[model samples]
Target: MAFFRPGVSREAEVRHHADQEVGKSFGELLEKARGAEHELRRTQASRAGAAELRAAGLAFDRALTDALRAAEAAQRAAFGVKAYDDRIRRRKGVATPEGARWTAEVNKLRTLREENRLTGIARVPRPFAPAR
Candidate 1:
C-alpha cells in the first residue's frame, strides 16, 4: 500500500508559504519601525545646540511621539490586532521570561493554524483502508 499522501504535502506547502508571508510582513514592519526611530534620534541630536530651543523642543517631542506610535503600530500589525487610539489601553501588560509578555497570544495563533492544517489532513479519506 502506498503510504504517500498526495494532497497532504501540498497542503503543508501552502501552510509553509503562508507562514513565510507572515514572517516577511513582520520583518518589514520591524524594519520600518527601526528606521523611524533612527530618523527621530537623528533629528533630535541635530537640534541639540540650536538657538530656537523652544521650537526644537516641540519638534523633538512630536518626533518622539511619532516614533513611539510607529513602534506600537508595527507591533500590533505583527500580532494581527486591532489598532487603538490609545496604545496603553489595548492589553494589560503581563510579565514573562526575558520580558516576552504577550507571547502567549502569538503561540495561540500558531496553535490555531496548526490545528486547522491537521483538521484539513484528517478530512482526507484514507487511500488504502481495509474493507469495513
Candidate 2:
C-alpha cells in the first residue's frame, strides 16, 4: 500500500506554476542569447567591441544559473531528486549547452575571417571607386 498525503498544499501547487513560468523565462533568455550569437557571428571581431561580447557572455551565464536554480526548486516542490536528475540528463533541446558554446563558435568564425582578410584572401576583387 502507498502512503499518500491527504491534501496537496497550495504552496506545492503555486510552486508548480512557478516552475513552469521559470522555464519559459529561461527559454526567452536562451533565445536572446542565440540572437546575440548570430549578431556576433555576422560581425567581424575587428569591428565588434569586446565590451559588448563580454556583456552577452555575462547574460548567458546569468540565465544558465537561473535555469539551474529553477530546476532545483521544481525538484524540491516535486519531492524527488532522481526524477529531476533523470529529466536533466535526458533533456535534448535548444536549451542545451549551446548557450555557452555559441560564444566560441562565433569567435572561431571571426578568427577565420580575420585571418583571410589579413592574408588578402577576400571574396571581393577590388574596392569600388566613385566618379570624380
Instruction: Please tell me which predicted candidate would have the highest TM-score against the true structure.
Output: 2
Measured against the true structure, the TM-scores of the candidates, in listed sequence, are 0.28, 0.37
Candidate 1 CA-lDDT value: 0.41
Write one digit per residue (lDDT tens) for candidate 1, span 88-119: 42342223231133354345434533543343
In candidate 2, list every pair of residues with a backbone clash. Answer: none
Question: For model 2, how does the per-residue alpha-carbon lDDT over 1-132 read when each residue is reduced to its tens digit?
Answer: 999844645664676567655545545554654565455445435455555554544444444445445444433434322323345522432134542343344354445434433442223335689889
Clash totals, every prediction = 0, 0
Clash number for candidate 1: 0
> Scored by CA lDDT, what does every candidate get?
0.41, 0.45
Error of 1 at 82 (Å): 7.6
Model 1 clash pairs are none
RMSD of candidate 2 to true structure, Å: 13.9
